[model samples]
Target chain A: MWELIRANKRNSIVLMVIMASVLLVLGFVIGMVFFGQEGGFFGLMIATTIWLVLTLISFSSGDQILLSASRAQPITHEVHPQLFNVVEEMKIAAGLPAMPKIYIINDPAPNAFATGRNPQNASVAVTAGLLARLNRDELQGVIAHEISHIVHRDILFVTLAGIMLGSIVLLSQVFLRGMFYSSMGGSRRRYSSGGKGGGQAQIVMLVIAIIAAILAPIMAQLLYFALSRRREYLADAGAARLTRYPEGLASALEKIAGDPSPQLATVNKVTAPMYIVNPFKKAKQIKLSNLTSTHPPISERIKILRNLSQGASFNEYSDAYANVTHKKTIVPVAALSTKEDVPLRQASAEAGSEERLDKQMRQVGDIIRRVNQFIFLTCACGLKLKIPPNYKSNKINCPRCNKSLDIPRK
Target chain B: MGTSILIVFLILVGIPLLLILFVIGIYNALVRLRNQVDNAWSQIDVQLKRRHDLIPNLVETAKGYMKHERGTFEAITQARSQAMGAKTVSEAAKAEGALGEALSKFMLVVENYPDLKANQNFLAVQEELTGTENKIAFARQSYNDQVLFFNNKIQMFPSNIIAGMFGFTKRDFFEIEVAAEREVPKVSFS
Candidate 1:
């Protein structure tokens, strides 16, 4: 993931250089055609200055702006210790230098994002809905996915795209205003004679300028979205590598896709790509049209993830998505129940008048027991103990101290 | 003529745009690194608090078993105090080490009393404390990771240039200096 992030950073720099050169040439051509040589030169200068100023402001304050926009409140461990632990574990796994701060948004939608120009100054924010909804493994998967974004510096790409889009929109507006004023001035300057030819030429210029104004922003937005979609795929691949559990992320995506919430209040078009799942819920009413939207269809994303989980190659995953039907699978909630009897076994059996509740409790207890096997214990006798499956016997003696013990019956 | 126009356009507009994007990228990266460090520290804080919360219950559980082990109990309390009192990263690491050692010694004393080990309250507190310890270790690892990323960025090229220009300096990783610091002192029943 780190290597990919480094490569992406280099790629972004090269891309920026190419993009700037293209824009510069475009600006020059437009300037020369519309204005005299000196006017064209000054116009390009003004555009560059505007771009530079906007870029700097966004770079330095972009994370803060995004955080504030998302209404992400800074969280202490007291607020959510489980989240803190998962992030901590991931940070170590990634060999990061410092742990990124965690934040929680009050919204009920299950979504998460990482922000900061780099890992050190980074933060991971998740909706309160996510914390309440996801189990440990699912939460780990989601957080890992967000951390991948931070590692990959995808946020930088998104920010730059946004700036470019903004610049394009601004330039289009400038062109429109310039055409309007220029035509009005030309009208005032012309007295009689060849008014028809001059008026026709002015009208052609106005139409061209209006068309450019309307179309340029849309084109820029499409370009931005295309770049974002690629970054999302790259981030997903990076996350899968970092977690070494494609199923973890795949399951997380399944859950996110199944959720039926509207777009998060904090999200706008610009910050939407930063999320682990696209926070913006597409309108169910709209027909499938690739005409306007940014994100690749969520159903398709989940299918790709499912393919990845099956150990399919990335090429295979992509190919599978290309031909897969976009039908939603109705996953019965009962089928999702794995180890549901575990936690219940720990509950004292005395209060069980409700048979169904008792059955559910037993399921929970069973799962807890299975989970307990993973929990390491250091016995008082200075012996490391691994609880065995059949150790549920009446009197289990400690191997080192020969002390008799009663293993708690859960 | 068009080539000249392109060259002039690049010189006048292209360089500034590239510089702007680079600046934005570097600045955002630094901010992200800084936030990660803060997050890592908070994780440690949460675990420490959990550990601290478990201490009173642990001491109480041991109190009935080790009536004569007043010195060990006092040491554990003192260590916990020192750990809690620690403000800086190095200080917290040292204090936490002391607390772990003291807690282990206290646990060893409990080994002598079969009744204490059997007591559900003691077992619960012990289990909870162990869980907290695991959390702290994870948090420490995370903190170190973020610090590494932040420090590397400040030291690496291009971004480093921007980092230096912006007065962003490398941060020290929160780490246990000695193996002894990480070891929970062994309590022997023999």
Candidate 2:
């Protein structure tokens, strides 16, 4: 997994550089055409600044923003103990240094994603629907898949790609709209039109500028979709290798893909690719050949995961994928060489009971209460003291016994 | 003349700076690898502590129902104390192996007693102890992996030179030595 993660970092760097260079080139072209010769340098400067700022902000605090925006409350073992245990198990499987923080959204939509700059700073968020819907092995499978994403450094690339792609689309819209306003004025054209040879060149540049502006964001987006689809396949393979139970993830993918509610209240296009299946539940028949969407078809991903009964290795994934899609080269050759094959395990398909799930949900509620600054203390007389996180006291007296309990002063 | 000056500038200034940067990067990475090995060892420590804490409760829960199983209970206590005293990884492995053998024998004896098996408290403790055992095995595997990676870094070519310079020595792996658990749980990458 470490070797695979190193390889992933290399690929992410190469892709990010490619995306940023494209953005810079577009900026240069647009600037030069609009403001004569000097705007090219200014354009590069502006684009570099935007790229730097976006990457810096996202690198530092993007995970928090993503979690908070989705109304995901941070949870601990005391509250959502089973989820913590599962995360711990996956951490051991993925060989992560520590368990990534866990969060739960109150919404009933069944979606989950991993986010952060790296494994240490990473977080995994799941909706209430996800907890209520999937069984234990299925839940483990989803977690392993998310852990794979963190181990592979996919989160950083996704965040950086999103920033660059967003900047390009925004800039393109600004330029296209500027062209509209300038054309309506029609006064600036006469000044440039005074020089005969220069006038013709300017008109050609304007036409090319308009064409480039219209095409650049679309081109960037297509590249992004291309990048994430391959990473998703790799993450699935990584998840299988970690859990040694491909069918667990395979069946979970089936449940998620088959789920009726596809829309998440907090999801947008930028964070959609981070999800196991595309959150747009409406796109039922997303195909590998389709160039429009960020994720490959859910049915195909499930088929490939189910095919891993043969073995868990990059080569086996390629073979299984080939069996289903009749196409090879799903995993890159460099990654294939570093991949280790693990022996297959027979399916142990025990599902969790509803009683257990109810307990787990109640635990999640207690965790949310704790996260919201609610203080809980136990007394010798079998009574509980409930106080807020910001209760502002160094000590609290137990209501039943009236004995003082020490509170860590912040 | 301008190209010749640039070449001289690169050789005289650029080379030393690059060399210094390379040394710093390799040194930092080696330190990071060593720290990861330490952290993985601590995870194993945490799991072992959990197992140790659960053993007393397990014995206490089963004591009343199994009067004839007094010998097995004593053996478990002896093994537990031995494991607690075991200081090194290899020593701990041997101690743990003996403990596992005793515990498995104890479990086999447990099958004859219907009252102990039916006790709700005994069942919960047994479930928890089994979970702890699984966690302990995983933690050991994780530790060995980290140690192996750390060992590789210190022995490999270019970085080994820096490792030697920085005194980063190779660490021992956590191997499960008992035949019972070892037979089923071997690390078979082949």
Highest DockQ model number: 2
Clashes of each: 49, 4
Give every collision pair in model 2.
A79-A363, A262-A281, A373-A389, A375-A387
RMSD of 2: 7.0
lDDT per residue, candidate 2, A1-410, as tens digits? 55566777777788788788878887887887777667888888887888789878888998888789889988766555556666777887667856799998877677788999887789999887787777667887898899989888888788889888888887788888988887889847654654878777777877887888888888888888888998999989888877778988988888787777647888777778888878876655444357868887789999898887767877888888899999876877676764353665544324366776676556445555676768776667877667787678779888667888887544
**What digit string (tens of lDDT, one per residue) describes model 1 on residues A328-384?**
322212322311111000111112236634443343333333333422345678775
**Lowest lDDT 10-mer window, candidate 1 chain B?**
B177-186
Off by over 4 Å in 1: A1-3, A18-37, A174-208, A288-292, A308-410, B1-190
- List chain B TM-scores, each candidate: 0.86, 0.87
Model 2 residue A53 CA deviation (Å) reads 2.2
lDDT of 2 by residue, B98-189 (tens): 98788878887887887887675786677566556646655665666667777877888889999999888989877668767645534458
Each prediction's TM-score versus the true structure: 0.54, 0.75
Q: Cα lDDT for residue A175, model 1? A: 74
DockQ, in order, for the candidates? Answer: 0.09, 0.22
